[model samples]
Target: MHDIMFHKKIKKTLSTIEEVLNNNNKNIDFDYLLLDNMLEITFSNNKKIILTSQIFLKQLWIATSNQGYHLLYKKRTWICIRSKKTIKKILKKEFFIQTNYLFKLNLLNNI
Candidate 1:
């Protein structure tokens, strides 16, 4: 289990990241955090959901087999790709984009 202080830090960092994403002017619905080398995110698709990944997260300088990052921002879906090779593969393949954000207020909304 994680301590309250640690969780608080993650929450704060997520807020900052949210501002950064929202500034992008896309319609996004998610919050994100960096835990060690992994990123834990809360997002919504047809509905709300949560997800976790340990790779391909550039915001925290972590990369795995994946190469692109997707998010909902400014009411639009946007993708940030790290490498062109990975981007090409992801674009060529038919894959479901699974990503979102979970903010402090989002918790309340879920409740």
Candidate 2:
């Protein structure tokens, strides 16, 4: 993918996550901060899950307190190259592990 397209996808994905976190359920267990190409999610227990765009590698890097995953955009979704999981799956699992809450990531369905 072109660098511009990769950046756009990253931005859109991050923005969608932010929207889902803030709008859908309003879970007080966690809050999110979105940067240019990164998302920092802090849980009430002080654990964190980070989503970073690696433009140089054309991938998304997600890190939780206990694990990390690298995902590449494929067939309109970001999928882990090794695990073969979608970004939504990874984020959902990590969010639950970090916050003990299930996030309503409805807007991210298309990503």
- Candidate that would win on TM-score: 2
Tens-digit lDDT track for model 2 on 1-111? 999899889999998888878864565677778979999988888888899998889999998889889999998899999999998888888877766777776677777
> What's model 1's overall lDDT?
0.34
lDDT leader = 2
lDDT of 1 by residue, 7-102 (tens): 443344344444444553255555655554244444454322222222323221222234434421111112233342222233223122443322
Q: Ten consecutive residues with minimal summed lDDT in candidate 2?
A: 23-32
What TM-scores do the predictions have? 0.27, 0.92
In model 2, what lDDT does residue 52 have? 95
